[model samples]
Target chain A: MTAHASPIGPGPTGPGPTAPPPAPPAVSPLRLVATLGISGALAGLLLVSVHRVTEPVIAAHKQRVLEDAVLEVLAGPTSYRTLYLVDGAFTPDLPAGADPRTLDTVYAGLGDDGARLDGFAIPASKPGFQDKVSLLFGWEPKDGTVRAIRVLESRETPGLGDRIEKDPAFAAGFVGRTTPLVGVKAGRGTGAPSEVDMITGATISSRTVIDAIDTTLARLRPALDAYAAEAAR
Target chain B: MKETTAREDLLRGIWRENPVLVQMLGLCPTLAVTNSVANSLAMGIATAFVLLGSSVLVASVKRLVPGEVRISAYVLIIATFVTVADMALEALAPGIHKALGAFIALIVVNCIILGRQEAFASKRPVGRAALDALGTGAGFVIALVLMGSVREVLGSGSFLGHPLFGAHYEPWVVMILPPGGFLTLGSILIALSWLRRRRAAAAGEARS
Candidate 1:
């Protein structure tokens, strides 16, 4: 049997152009797997390294913003101290009754000498028309009222609900208001002492803030009163 | 005295191929955050930072990325830069960060970043890719500012939060809402098309 008469056709292993292009030297399955694995590992390492570099700076910046928010809500305090609430009482240290997951952080603003109390800035949140309206509200027990309020986070409607932050009159109305705050229409007289004038187009957002302050204060009043008694001692 | 090709590459995005006006790539942010100048500027800067960083990274590592898996690799790289930008913005400028909110996080999915990566960066050198990304970013910012200014001035009678009109100037409430974004963009697109038609007509007249 000559070579041409063989049962099987000739498999041309030569570098001829017509030889099915040599199968383009297909990448081995192992090589493909290794390449993908290395690429993913490198990407992960890069992300981890970046996270490491930025983590501390980000944390520090957030702390600074929070501190600033405390001062802002308190109308610019000289110094501040963070207190934790547990079992209807405020304490310097985290209390045993305080749920680690939902512990309420209360910031005590101190005067220039750091002895006299300026006010307390407490964060609160409530659902608005669109989403949660997170805020920091300042309270002074001496006045039996809220000192000021600063929006910490809000996803209110752009032109309407956001007016809670944008409108000066609406924000100013929050200051010096008593607990159990109420939100009313802009032109409608705040018939009661604890009422806030809602932004013209942002009744829901305004009510969200007022209701949040009222609810948060109702929950914290006992702790604040207890703290006041402890201070008197 | 001029480098024509480089200049063309840089300026092309501004008018000829604006990511917003002409190309219409990143309309999600273009429409969503253009309510006020402040928000639009913040979003633009954040998006630009992500785009520029991702373009450079993708260009540098393009060769290593396998063709079949390149899209995934590019997306991962883009997401990494976007997260870094978002974190940096939140830490450095919390107010603007808050105002920008999820839009900052949404930069990861902005087609402008991914488009640049898939179309230009992966095929070019790092320097060129970065320049292209910068041009595109600047164009995006300009477009955002235009929309923002129109919306803010008309809707709120303010520019950059400062009152631009007198007390008697009644704000057009629609300009600042979602519809206002569409209106402003639509007007801008119409104006652009008109100008283009005029230019084309003039060129045709000259040829005739």
Candidate 2:
């Protein structure tokens, strides 16, 4: 009976040895680290590849959009050249510019032949009702008057402040407007080249654009005049 | 009976478990970008692309990931696709890109895509995962377009930028504002719930 019991016990226990033991309670440090590292590396590789492939395309598209804006403001120039403002002076490249760089960009519109100077498209930015109001406007240096204006970027309110771009009548007021610009209430009579009728609701945003254009034009007028003369000669 | 048919898996997200209306995920962009139809369309397409790509990639690689770092892994994968989508949109459609602005980059944090990766895609085969992603994405698009149409038509008195009302018609100015998003969504939810209740009652009567 004892021998039989022993044989039975051993037979029952034999199957347990063949069955797989439970996995370790925790993942080994090496395996965990390796897994994370591999996942990270794969993700990094994918991002890098996408960035590399799309970088040039994105840059080119941005350049094209800016060019289109310039054309619209400058009344359809055939070509344009970007000049940079560095340390109170203009330069074509950044390497040769001074350390305290303003890096302001001015686009000089060229005529159909691409040789004669047409006008200048200068970008300007200033605080608005909500945020920064940045825009590009064409300058006819001969008359020292703004040809046209297009908002490049703005973060004003949707219905009111956003009227700066949405209201074509308001934007139309900028065409042929002279500098030292001032914004008054809409529907007010336009008696002066410097006076502009602000949007009915968006006084601050309208004022922001008018003031920014005025200040920027005032500062850059001399340099712009000199550049235009040089290009014409 | 526990697992659904492939067709059901493909169709479920469109209505039964919609990412936006039913699941109530990814509302930030829904409210922000649906101010206009064009913006809504662009945002929806961009989101769909990101969702589909991330789901497929995650489904294919689910087994290799350890449970401990799975969330981080999923985020890393999702972020990669978001970056790709952002760059692709910027390159291909600059106007849309400019209109959508940072919301395109914000797609990475959209809970719907990450939720799918964690809950459904990680457990399913790649084919089924993709189908689910597509359904969910289509549902999101439908919801956005619905809201966009309503807002654009009522707020601006236009449909997709075309004037639907005469000059004398005054638009509901509140419809284009942020509060309008909340009001429209609330009304839609109420209407959907009412329809659902009516259907349930009819089904119960039939069973009786």
Candidate 3:
């Protein structure tokens, strides 16, 4: 195969008063292949080294952040346990042959007694105004109200759609609100049990948060109920 | 081309050829992550690390690379450094890493790093390349912080999460949104051009 000449070198010059530019040096195919191969190898080596060095630290950091989010959304529970959804049931153990990464897991925040359930911190995500909005919300099964919410990840439009995660009023509206919440115009909630005050300019993002929680709860509430009953027994 | 001194190489990117404001390179991260001061600072440092590392490596290996594959080689080198920076940021400062989000990984595609490698690092000596990287990195950081300060102060009524105004301050919400980035950058560019023109006129009058 003919070697592709470097574009950086001068192109073929037509005869002119100025002496024609010297012919570009021929690049050997082997050398070109070796250059790319060595670069690829070096890149692979560097990335591998960095990944090894940072893997544990990143994992620990993620775990810590997840724990903090769980606690914040669950309203400062003494501790929390990971419950995997298996066959429509919440079990503390991972299901056979199921990847933990792909499995749907919820955190059951425990009260001081270690056995009392404070609430369930359910993590959910849905496409928002700009990107997917991931959040964790504390669900009180007994009262059927959301306790609190923490936006774990979101790329909503800053200062506007991002108010879903930043605005205190928007978050406060979710606290103690009934399940399957309804999004209303900002400050137009009639103090109804299921009404949520959406950010004025971020209706899509606000609705996305509600939809994420409501859909997850709708799919998991039956299993959650079973799990709660099993725990009670 | 006139040969540049080390000091000139180190200082040019800060104002004369700034990667963000003056040259208008790397605007993706500039606009996306500059809504808050902390995020802007974190991204600037991360990008700086990648640029510096890639430039140094590219300069060192310039001879080894054939012209046919120079761009590919530079991209590989850049991607490596970007990955290293991304991993380091996630490990050392996960909160900032999270806030920066996909922008960290997206640094591999940032034109500033590659443009420097092709335009300066591949041709210059290692020391010169390093100086250029530092200058460009500093410029990028300065531009990001300037944008961040404006957006955060006006959009959120705070600076780095601290409220600059009293409780009554009403935030200009649009200032932190995407449009805010364009508006802020446009205003800064206009002001910079105006200042430059005024300085040029004064210099011309004195010379006359």
Q: Tell me each candidate's TM-score.
A: 0.76, 0.83, 0.82
Tell me how each candidate scores on DockQ against the true complex: 0.13, 0.22, 0.29
- What would the C-alpha RMSD of candidate 2 be, to one decimal place? 11.0
Ordered list by lDDT, greatest first:
3, 2, 1
Model 2, position B34, has a per-residue lDDT of 90
TM-score, candidate number 3: 0.82
lDDT (10s digit) by residue, model 1, range B103-160 = 8878877877776776677766788778888889999999999999999999989999
Model 3 Cα displacement at B52 (Å)? 1.3
Candidate 1 CAPRI category: incorrect
Interface RMSD of each: 19.4, 19.9, 10.3
- Compared with the true structure, what per-residue lDDT tens digits does model 2 show for residues B1-208? 1476678777877877776777677778888889788889889988889989999998998777777777788888888888889988888888889888999999988877876776677778999889888988888888888888888889888888889988877888788888999998889888988998999999999999
Candidate 2 clashing pairs, residues 3+ apart or interchain: none
Better of 1 and 3 by lDDT: 3
Q: Model 3 over residues B74-156: C-alpha lDDT tens digits?
A: 88888888889889998998878878889998998888888777678877899999999999999999999999999999999
TM-score of chain B of 1: 0.94
Model 2 chain A worst lDDT run, 10 consecutive residues: A1-10
Native contact share for candidate 2 = 0.30
Give the best candidate by TM-score.
2
